[model samples]
Target: MTKGYIHIYTGDGKGKTTAAIGLAIRAVGAGKKVCILQFMKSLAYSEQKILQSIPGITLITLGKPYFIAKEGMLTDEQRKTWGNHIRIYPAGHPPKDYREMTLKGIEQAIDAVSKNYDMVILDEYNMARWYDLATEEETEKILKARRPEVELIFTGRNAPKEILDAADLITEMKKIRHYYDKGVPVRTGIEN
Candidate 1:
């Protein structure tokens, strides 16, 4: 029997989701079943196409068509890049649709673990906890539900202390250098 570990990819940097996707690809290549649930994002990136075409990988995104941004805070580049899906708001409240989507995603996490998937990746789930869309306690409950053989992964920035404490492995992608800070737009296949 295989022993699965709980891992977290987090921090104020890039590549958290990318790292999870890499892990998913590795898992699939090794003949393991994988379930990838993306939270708070709806952009159709190039990888989505590849992941969909790949066998043994199930990918689902729980988010509105629009992206969330703090009102009056979007840079010119941000507005230009995400012009189609900008949901700028004055308050701190996340959109109701995103909340609903995330709640459903949480349920799906429980279901995925119960079904004995080899690996379950909850991408950007820490954002849900950060925005109060889901509580740390709720996330903890899902972690508890995972079977001993179910590999669980959480990815995002601003992960709660409780979540970090619960993880068997945690990798923080610290942003020491980033081109995004240099006014370069997101590359088509690299950062999109």
Candidate 2:
């Protein structure tokens, strides 16, 4: 039997979640089942529509509606536009609802790895740990308990060293340049 290794996509750049989604699609296309447990995000992005359309894919989002940002990270325009929905000041202590959602996501991920899916993708999991929404030890325990044939993918920035050391393949997506510097809002089908 072929061994399915653990993979991680981490760094400051984008495309980590996108890459995991691509792999999930490939697995489903090859007649394998995929389960995506999204942490710290609940917005139904454009990709969610397509994921719902995919037959062998199960996508679950356990996150709050608002995105977390540092106090000074939001530009004046952004503050004025999305001030109501944004969370600023001390990104470490996320809202109780978000924490609850992320904990639920971790539980789902554990279940997915143990008995449900051929491939399990923990989207934005690193950030979940960084934000105190999840714990590295609990997640690692799940990884160790997963079936040998199950493929596991963890995506996010600032991945803990413990996770990197456990993963068989680690790819860091470095950010060289981004259109956000050019004053471009996230487009519906593109960045969203």
Give the CA lDDT, 0 to 100, for residue 3 in model 1: 92
What C-alpha lDDT, on a 0 to 100 scale, does residue 13 get in candidate 2? 92
User: Model 1, range 1-192, lDDT digits (tens) per residue?
Assistant: 789998999998999989999999999999999999888767477778888889999998787767777566788886998887687765557677777778898999989987869999988889878766787767877888888899999999988888888899999999999987898988878987
lDDT of each residue in 1-192, candidate 2, tens digit only: 568889999999989999999999999989999999888767568898899889999989877778776566678998888868877656566677777777777778888888968999998899888776777777787777788889999999989877888899999999999998898989988877
Q: Give the clash count for each candidate.
A: 0, 0
Clashing pairs in 1: none
* TM-score of every candidate: 0.88, 0.90
Q: Could you tell me the lDDT of residue 48 within candidate 2?
A: 88
Error of 1 at 172 (Å): 0.9
Off by over 4 Å in 1: 70-84, 88-92
lDDT of 1 at 160: 87
After aligning candidate 1 to the native by TM-score, how far in Å is the CA of 128 from where it should be? Answer: 1.8
